[model samples]
Target: MENKLNDQKISSTIETEVLVVGAGNAGMMAAAAAAEKGAQVMIIEKEDSINLLRLGLAGVGTNAQKRAGMTIDKYELVEYLAAFAQHNVDEGLIYHWANNSAEAVNWVEDNILKPHGAHLRAEPDSLVTSSAYQGFSTENDPTIDDETFVSYGTWFQEKIAALGVNLSFKMALVKIIKEGNVAVAAIVKNISSGELIKINVSKGIILCTGGYSANEELLKKWNPLALKKNVYNDSPRNNGAGIVSALDIGAIKDEEPAECIFDRGLVPVGKKTEEMYVQTATYEDWLWLGSHPLLKVNLRGERFANESVPYQFTVNAASKQPGYLYAMIWDDNFDEYAKQFHTLGCARVGFPGYMANAKKLREDTQRYVDKGLVVQADSIEELAEKLQLPAENLKKTVLRNNELVKMNIDKDFGKEAYRLTPINKKPYYGCILGGRILCTSDGLRVNKKMEVLDANYEPIHNLYAAGNDSGGFFFGSYPDRVPGLAASHAQTFGRLAGQSAAK
Candidate 1:
């Protein structure tokens, strides 16, 4: 521990057994795990307060899963994950996550969540209706108790506070100092004061600084398609400073960087915009893809994909469209259908706060329409004109969709028979949808032990990566349907990395 001050650059040095960057779920969990082992731990977070943008963890065969009668076929789970990543992820790392997720969930459940008056809720019954994975929730189960569901980040913050872990918020990692091939220290900036502090970790520095969704440069270099399609400024805190520092220290990169592609409505890029998305029964409720059976047309007014597929696939297809925009064409039966299916909200079914309130959502969307951010017309052709699309193509697309409805089969896009509702009613409605990136998946390459590896496949001594900051965990695209995969991997590996770094 050393401190040196100057007029322009006041420098200080602090030594700890474990240094965790970014106070998100991974960083917090890692810090707590290290402190539990009696290691002096320090966490530096960029935000004034921690974020819970995406909460929940994905685990298999936990006590909650067992209690809920959810049986996890280990072999099947591995196969499914492989298929999801198209066999591009690190096989050993994926297996490690699959095998240890149960214990990790239970561990946190006992130490962190339970103390905060929260319990892990594994509703395997959710799997019967959706292909999305069923993981554990640390939030209160309204079915069992009255305490509302709080995010695992909330629980982690609580536990870390109780453990007296040293945390400095608004302190951003600026650089990593390497002595020969080994990482020796880190330079962090006091965001408000513009001062720098040098931290020397005798044990290790765990990089849990999250993904690069906010960095346009990384988005362009790694995933250009996402840069064009993403509508919102999500994950603004994760600017890839950690990954850059690791790269500067000779860390390797994943072959295929991934991203969480989400279904987003039209939002102006450079304007102070109100809420542009509406929770309609058509898309927000079921699998966050929108209520099923809506006619999906590209900018040219042509059917593009199987609307019945998972929303991620839909986002992928929609991203290639002109301006990364697509029209979800539907008729007056939307309210009726949404009510029948119980997806009447504007956001994800279980997630009420991510554009949460239905009344507010409707009101905001209507405001956008009044301002011409959304288009509403009495007829399909007029609607197409307002969207600057070909009227005949739009009309033909609708007529063909109606024919499929009559036939009760989607021969073109393989849409299911039940979703073949004709768009024949008057006062047709359409919203221009844009793809959005939840987080970037390209991170420093790490092995099963959560060790950051160099280009030659050797561990960068005393350096580790976890959560969205670690690579080889995903490829191509994010699997949101695999409920809790992000959170589970973060906490599970964060725990493992913490223990490993402490040792």
Candidate 2:
């Protein structure tokens, strides 16, 4: 098929049965699945190499779950996830994930992880649930050293390459060529050479370019509230190129704006939210101790919402606070308190059977203290002074929090008793907290088959979207309670889309 490009020169043309864009978690899975189905697959990644940062995969009834004596009702999980979005999500997509996530996870284990030295381990169940949101223990993380987590990405790349998929880096998808309403080819640009190449796709084009978390303009347009407080932590390449291309070709997107924001974005003592953008700090800068349900006070030195809620809820509350920032105040016994908090998902790194690296938590906290990002004082008044808060208000808040700790009850915010650790142990520490955006949770609409849908809710022929590039699963906020739900959704639907498109 010869497609004319206005004011653009094509340096070369390649033919493939499936063209997968953005070689992240979803694109890799899609390419591998298409190759497994005996289809010629070509993957183009804008980056020089694949992203190595790994997230746990949520699954139900998987072999790992069986071995760990963990049983989850997939239907109940589907309902909980839907309710998490206030029924604004596509429950069918959530059901699709619940049904096939096990297969997808096991596929990774059998083909990519287990064959190598790595294996999947389930996250520990929550110690207690007092809130309406219930978190499941279905998150599975690869057994690898945190420093060498890149090995998992390497193994996946090797596995897919062995399946005869052509993977190229530094090639970014510019646009999808469509004839009528059917996608036929794609125009990609070589980032290093600035040369445009056309790939004729006979089967389909799978967009896995992630979401617009890093796109400030899109964030301001769709999720202005989230943008007002969040520090972008995702890859900058996620600029909605895939979604924009699909939209240009008549694909519809989710109406409600959503984001996967987490708590613990460390804001410097006097830094404003506007000064925060792409977080360039190392992992040591992450306020891991802040993930614990510390006594959070606004700049006015007043206690706010229940700090024991989900990570994003803390940020949501902070968004309404003065300057969209809050301070997490704790004592020297944060290590013990963190364990008592029993935080779920990625924040569960201190526990066993997951990423058991508690030492890093302490080290990170100390690093922040050394850098002055976190203030350390021996007294409540002194700590309040260092944090630039009203000393009397902070002292009263701490006294009240201590009383709650003594009573084993949070009368004000109804925080779970177990997570209500006292901040009166002496040598008080405080760090200003903000929101760190992981990704946008809304994008191009897709059905269970991972087919991109048009305005009339009909499939855009031969066009597929998976991962953050596609939506209809989430609205308003990310369901972190599900634990690795986003990654699992990406892997599962990416495979499904690749299989459907290859057919």
Candidate 3:
């Protein structure tokens, strides 16, 4: 592929006022916004159809929120977001999203959702928002090619196409043509015919091609230390093509790449399967273990950081472990843990069994032990033996943990009293806990207007980046508590990029 790049001949050429790449949430939003501004918008999507898994989006102040009588302090929310990123995030960008997202949400609802009898489902919590289609039958719509088609993307594409925006499918971005430091055009490939087409941009090019989570090479280079463990990348299509093309034209990169890390079940080796592995021993073993307050210990049978902290911090501690796996140990008095406070208490994201039925959680635990996903022992020593850790170390750690339980204080890790669960009862159990990056948060550095910037902090002429392709939105780690941040960024920044590029 590299050798043929120099001799490659362009098959055809097209011109557009705004060229939007990738047809995911951000890309479609960008194209619609540009077209609404009367720009000749052309969207090139690599997939046969777009909006594969966009269930819903996030927004702060919207018609849905207003109807629900919900209000979030924009100032406090911005401060919370900045502090969540440890002040490594862009405050201007946060404020921009907080202020502008309501309009975008209302636009999407009014244009695509309301007509279909669907609406934005705003949870009682301000952060948790979703676009719920109440089983609205689309079988009557003639434009729906698939009989089973029911997604925000499908509705959004139809709406945009009606607005005179050209939607081209099976077209992949191969390269970007730059004049000096300005992005002038892009080289796109037709996946079916193996034909390359040049798209000249008269206004600007907005790259919503997503992040480098799907590219292993880019992951090893940028997010190596943080994501050393095996990852379960959710977006298999986001291969960093946009970031690479931007960098090839001297687009500045973000200072550090952030990862969307969360505690998940044991990932299978040698094959990529979306199978959900449920951990039985502790809270982290189950999927989306961020909200679960469980006691975790490293390979040396030593409690490291506060387990109740952010999920990314826990995953970071696991990366520092010997094999990038930690143990969540508990005792046979599992009924003591049967209280729904930690597991089923909080109404956060839920898996199949535990959150639904606590009794089913124990049943699943035993089943996993039978399946060898969890280790069960008649004693702590035996559990240690099975885990391949020093027996004395395990015993000592359990002893210290019991002492902490009695005192209602975690002297070493500074764990809260309510979270100090002692592993004292017979039939001790343990399960390995670890998680992988769902996506990357670092890419081409962009300003508040979503304009791709150069090293000198000047916007690259006619070049913009939205969604994960843009940077300065996140740093250090992805906060699980924030809920709808990623979807919100895509909506807010994608619209911002479109408006700016149209101007």
Best by TM-score: 2
lDDT of 2 at 187: 92
Q: List the residue pairs that clash in candidate 3.
A: none
Could you estimate the TM-score for every candidate? 0.86, 0.95, 0.81
Give residue 124's error in model 3 in angstroms: 2.9
Error of 2 at 69 (Å): 2.4
* Model 1 lDDT at residue 137: 31
Candidate 3, superposed: residue stretches over 4 Å from native: 1-8, 49-56, 125-151, 265-291, 331-371, 422-428
Compose the digit string of candidate 1's lDDT tens values, residues 227-307. Answer: 666555457777898898899889987867788766654543222112332223223312232434478888788989877
Better of 1 and 2 by TM-score: 2
Q: Candidate 2: count the clashes.
A: 0
lDDT by residue for model 3 (298-404), tens: 77877777776656678787777776767778877664554533432122323211233455456756766776756888888898877766789888988888998
Positional deviation of residue 238's Cα in model 3 after best superposition, in angstroms: 2.1
- For this target, which candidate reaches the highest lDDT against the unseen true structure? 2
lDDT on C-alpha atoms for all candidate structures: 0.70, 0.82, 0.70
Mark the regions of model 2 whose C-alpha exceeds 4 Å error after superposition.
1-3, 144-150, 279-284, 349-359
Worst 10 residues of 3 by lDDT: 133-142
For model 1, the run of ten residues with the poorest summed lDDT? 135-144
